[model samples]
Target: MYRRTRRAVVTSLLVSSVVCGGAVVLAPAAGAAVPAASCTVTPGPNDTYVTISGEGFTGPRKLNDGESTVDLAIGPDGTFLVKRFQKNVDYTVLAVNEDQNFIFVNCKKVGTAATPKPENPQNTAPAQPGSRRDIAQGRAAGNQAGTAAAAKSCTTKPVADKSGQQHSDAYWQAWTQAANRSFNRACHTN
Candidate 1:
């Protein structure tokens, strides 16, 4: 209930933001210069290097060691932090929600966020070149690129299940998550 309303609100706020993306694909903004895009994460729990450059944002901007929330020029004209988030240190990039709000960026820092994998308090290792994890990550990035495209142009088909109760709650829950992820991957940001 709460999430639904929040997503709706967030989505509305980011309407003018272009939500589209991958490792480092550069694309032209509607009427603006081609925006640089990428998220670089320097490994460390405290001083993780997190820089995001995109269309409306300032380029390759360097973040402080403990910057959780960053002010960015992300609006239509590309100047201002329309949203107010604390300047704490979190591993977030320029990624944003569907409505384009920066508050819901899905940056999953190693130790701070919830996860099932063994926690790494030290944000060690920049992505390796050709390791298994690296390969999987490449695949996931490619898949997410496709998914983001499909989702942006993809329309939601009506659920055909007559009972309505047959569908698992997980499906309902994940729908928004998928959309947000796709939006982040494709255009909103890193």
Candidate 2:
């Protein structure tokens, strides 16, 4: 009976040591950190649009192409409304903290299916130089036609400005505002 008891104690100690070692190994190491927030992107099959969602991603994040980065707004809960992506395009979204380390969310490569390109090409002709009355009338007519065409072709609402530069600027501003807010809140609390 004493021999059996001694063997049981030894076995228990061995088991406990193995278990504790495994737990430590599985746990995150000290100073090895994850971002305070994260994001995910749901790209449509055709790659025309993506809905981005995350937590603590409010403000602006950068959308990077190989050569350049564009600022884009993140909703309060880390959501973004994205559009105008080409089919099969791969993109990366990054949120940078003050320390400059970034939390990156890679978007899936979109497939070319389900969504189709518009059959009717948009009119790109410049407005004709004319009298004030003619110009005003032409502008009104152009707006109406554009609205109708967009409503017919797009599943999602058209972005106010389709020019990439303008869109990028808007996103930059949003991110700046969000950063400022975060800074103020942190400062006040401390």
Candidate 3:
């Protein structure tokens, strides 16, 4: 009876160790698909440009609608300087990075002085040309106009997401390393 009890105890200890050790190996896999970082943009007055800020973003990326893509500056620490933008637009800003994260924002033109129109009941006189508001609108329009020109610049470039398997090995290796580091810190501590 004594020998049998000892054998049972040893088996239980071995089983427990295996179960606990497996957890450490399995934990890192969970974070493999996690996004590295994120960003946000808010539209300014007159629907000119938006102020963008966040972390883990490197800019000079393409901003696209279905028809166009524009290059825009991305500041360090992810803050976009006060910039003028066009009114009532939605943009899909694709970050030019290994992850190919796309940031989206919708801006509506608001709070402009009413224009008088003799041709129709709705006030639609082109917002006074060369006004401060108009200047902002012009700047925004310039960005919209240049999108196609900029996308042409990217024709030879690698897509950020690396859909072609060119960088898959490297990305997976890095992701695994990061996940292991996170798992060790989360599950095993001295």
By TM-score, the best candidate is: 2
In terms of lDDT, model 3 sits at 0.41
lDDT of 1 by residue, 1-190 (tens): 4335445544543453443422222234357553343332223333333333233444223222232334444446443322223223333334343322232333333333322345463434434444554444444544554465656554432222325333334343344455446655555454
Q: What lDDT score goes with residue 84 in model 3? A: 29
lDDT of 1 at 186: 52
The Cα error of candidate 2 at residue 80, in Å, is 1.0
Tens digit of per-residue lDDT, candidate 3, span 1-190: 4335434443443455466663212111444652344444555543445654444445655544334455666676553433425323443445443233333332223332343222542333444544544444443433433343334543332122335333234343443444344333443422
Best of the candidates, lDDT = 2
Top-down TM-score ranking: 2, 3, 1
Worst 10 residues of 1 by lDDT: 79-88
| Clash totals in order | 10, 1, 4
Task: Give the better candidate number (1 or 2) by lDDT.
Answer: 2
Q: What are the lDDT figures for the candidates, one per model?
A: 0.39, 0.46, 0.41
Name model 1 segments beyond 4 Å from true. 1-12, 15-27, 30-35, 45-56, 59-68, 72-190
CA displacement after TM-score superposition, residue 162 of candidate 2 (Å):
55
